[model samples]
Target: MGEDRREDMLDALHRLAEELGETPTTTEMNDRGEYWASQYQNEFGGWNEALREAGFEPNQVWKVPTDDLLNEIRQLARELNQTPTKEQMDDRGEYYGRSYLKRFGSWNEAVRQAGLEPNQRISQSAFREPPDACRLCGDAPDAGLDFHHWRYGENKAGCYLCRTCHDDVHAGGMRPDNDPGWLMGAVENLIRCHAKYSEETSVPAITSRYNIPSEGLVASAMSNVEM
Candidate 1:
């Protein structure tokens, strides 16, 4: 009885292959074949094993284009409005998660190739999606990205940032070991505001621009950093 069912599965697989003129995936078989891919797994140990038994080769990842896989990620990102997790890709994406791992060597690499950030979070304000947007200003790469060191000595491209953030780092003489070094930039801007507008006007202008909470603290920061 089991042998008869096995023969039937082989025959169904062969028929499907002939109709398609190439080896079909387990999903394809499930869609078009008389039997489900699960039935083949029950009899033949797995989809690829069943294909080998049926004289057809398993599909190769290289046969698919790199852009094809990356485009799928891009499409999913547009839908979710963020870089998707591996399980999210497996469930909602057209291709298997393993396909990305095999093609790109890592899921993060695949995300990066799609021109997005890996392990993405809604960063600094309501900024979301296309991981290349500035973590501070939330500017897209079209506005220009600058290579930023994560720390004073660790010259790693740790974060994606815009030219404005890049200039702020230097202009404020910030050598932060982490984060965008925003505090010093605030101090510098507030001091500049003091030079242009009176202290009364400067407080509101700098606070509005930097999103500083304590308006009085701007005066204190200016006092300490004033040259």
Candidate 2:
């Protein structure tokens, strides 16, 4: 009975894949996989093993559409209102990143290879000149200057934050410490402080909103915040 159900699901998925004119997105596959797994629990043992036998990998295959097949599918998807799944986007991003690495050597190299503009260099002479007050704390003799990411690269065009606010945000907002209530409080405080004290009039209020940080410097920076 379970085997029969599994076969039915596989057939359905195959049909959907055919209809899409491409490999199903990870989400699509996983949804189907889960349904099949539940329906065929006794025969397949579990979703993971069943999927593995069915030529599905939780990671690699799910990460992106199947290579050239993906590009074709993407073209088709674009014509319709349908958007690619998050996993599909991530997979494609990884693919692009890998391609960038191959053309260059690292992420920085990839950025440079793509002819993206480099970050502006701050001179040592500039560091010696101190601002009147802490950008975040509103205190004088600001202990250090740090860079903060305002909008993560994944979600928006990136921006910077000053050291005090940066540290406060990290210590208060990231995972473990990543409780929404706490982050909201912290971000609100940071924003209020920035609004009241920071010399930069253009600084936007820090709202305690939640978002997943990307997997590099942004992640590290947020992680380093001592909660």
Best-performing candidate as measured by lDDT: 1
Q: Ten residues in a row with the worst lDDT in model 1?
A: 122-131
List TM-score per model, in order.
0.36, 0.25
Please give, for residues 78-146, the per-residue lDDT of candidate 1 as tens digits.
Answer: 898877766667678866666677667667678889998654542232222224345455455565676
- What's the CA RMSD for each of the models? 13.0, 16.6
lDDT of 2 by residue, 119-190 (tens): 212222222333222335534333544434434354432223456556665664542236645533444444
Off by over 4 Å in 1: 1-49, 52-55, 58-63, 119-227
Query: On a 0 to 1 TM-score scale, where does candidate 2 land against the true structure?
Result: 0.25
Looking at model 2, report the run of 10 residues with the lowest lDDT sum: 203-212
